[model samples]
Target: MKEIMKDLKELMMKIDKFNSQQLNMLVEHIFDISNEDDILHLIH
Candidate 1:
C-alpha cells in the first residue's frame, strides 16, 4: 500500500503539468473507477 501510494504521488506530480481540461478528464475517469475510500483519500 505504501509503495502504491508512493507511485501514485509520483504519477500525480507528473500529471500536475497538464492543462486544466486534460486534468479534469483524467480526474473524472479516476473518480468513475475509484471506490468511496479512494475518493475520500483523494480529496483529503
Candidate 2:
C-alpha cells in the first residue's frame, strides 16, 4: 500500500509538470482505473 501510494504521488507530480491537455488526459486515465484510496491519497 505504501509503495502504491509512493508511485501514485510520483506519477501525479509528473502529471503536474505536464501541459494542460496532457495533464487532463493523464488524470482522466488515472481515474478510469484507479480505486478511491489511490485517487484520494494522491490528491491529499
What's the TM for model 1?
0.39
Clashing pairs in 2: none
User: lDDT values of the candidates?
Assistant: 0.81, 0.83
What shift in Å separates residue 29 of candidate 1 from its native position after superposition?
27
Question: For candidate 1, which ten residues in a row score worst on lDDT?
Answer: 14-23
* lDDT (10s digit) by residue, model 1, range 4-31: 9999999888777666769788789777
Number of the top candidate by TM-score?
2
What lDDT does model 1 reach?
Answer: 0.81
**TM-score of candidate 2 relative to the true fold:** 0.42
Listed in order, each prediction's TM-score against the native is 0.39, 0.42
